[model samples]
Target: MFIDTHCHLNHERLRDDLQGCLERALAADVRKMIVVGYDGPSSEEALRLSLAHPGILYAAIGIHPHDATTWNDAIAARFRELARMDAVVAIGEIGLDFYRDLSPREQQYRAFEEQLRLAKELDLPVIIHCREAYEETLSVLAAHPLPGVMHCWGGTPEQAQRAASLGLALGFGGTLTFPSAQNVRDSAMCIAPEHLLLETDAPYLAPAPYRGRRNEPAFTRIVAEKLAGLRCLDLDQVASITTQNAYRLFPKLALPP
Candidate 1:
């Protein structure tokens, strides 16, 4: 079985056809999925999905860097409350996105720092979303080390080593199959199996042949296959390694029998 460590089934694109998506994911052997939240409403929706699905789904709730402007004392309390719920596993999809700069840099840093503290407070791992801010991101993480997964990692091999050294697992998705994403491939090749994870980032970053199309949890199989090919390993090996890595990063994902 494979776990899509990060996806957004709560998003409108997939939620509109949620049942079909779930069926397809199961068919693809992508058994458990973590629906990550980028804001308040989506976080609630993610928790609802996890609660409704039980073993089949889980949640990671936090404010995305894009929505950092929305972060505040009240919002933090609400997220703290949500984080304590059984269905919620982590404190992210949080970090810097210097490329878009959607929220002011000041707010993004503030939100990222505060959320990092919150995750530390709750003793939960994090799901980081970094884009064009590896230096700053790693620096902050170094200052406040914690276990987590760098969702949809697109950093260089050096950055991959740095993240792993800091006890962060690196997630690879459809981008691993992109022709021009050599850096992602190289990073995947360099990271140890224990630190490797598979994700679809579904409703986005669909793999080849499915590229340019809407992504889904089913595509996690494609990512696993690609990672297997890149690592000169069997599909099952890749699946096993990544599933264990997912469990290591998000302890709550490993549901009771």
Candidate 2:
């Protein structure tokens, strides 16, 4: 079985044909998917999807850094309310994104801190999205005792070590499959398997053969293949180990048989 640990099913790319997308995912042995939400409406949709799908789908509710420009007290309160739902597994898709700078640096930091506090308060793991701000993100996380996964990891081995040292897992995606992604590949090779989780970040980062195309949970197999190659392990071993790693990170998931 395979699990796409980070995906945005509520995005327009998949929203129109969610059932078909899920069916394709399952057909490719993608048994479970975590639908991550970056805002209020998407979070609500994610929770509703989880409720509708029961054991097949799960939700992560939080605000993304891109939306930090709109972050306010009312939005925070709404996120808190959503986090209380049984179907909501984590507070995330949240963190700093200096790459886009869509939100002011100060606002990004404030939004990231508030959501981290909420996750700590709710006693739940966070699913973080960090880009070009590894140091800042690490600094913020260090200030609190929070459990989380750094989704779409793109940092130096030293940074990967730093994140691991702080008890956060590193999420690997299609970027690892790119021939030009030596940094990501090297980090994946050195990171502890137990602290590694696989994700597609789909409708986005599609792995090789599927690259430049619309990504889906099914393409996670390509990620597994690349990881297996990088670690010199068999495909089954890679799949088994990473699936277990994902289950460990998101214990709320109902693993398929």
Clashes by residue pair, model 1 = none
Stretches off by above 4 angstroms in model 1 are none
Task: Please report, in order, the local distance difference test score of every candidate based on alpha carbons.
Answer: 0.93, 0.87
For model 2 the local lDDT of residue 187 reads 89
What are the per-residue Cα lDDT tens digits for candidate 2 across 106-190? 9898888988888888887999999999998999899976888999999998899889999999999999988888989888988
What digit string (tens of lDDT, one per residue) describes model 1 on residues 93-125? Answer: 899999999999999999999999999999999
Name the best candidate (by lDDT). Answer: 1
Superposed Cα RMSD, model 2: 1.7
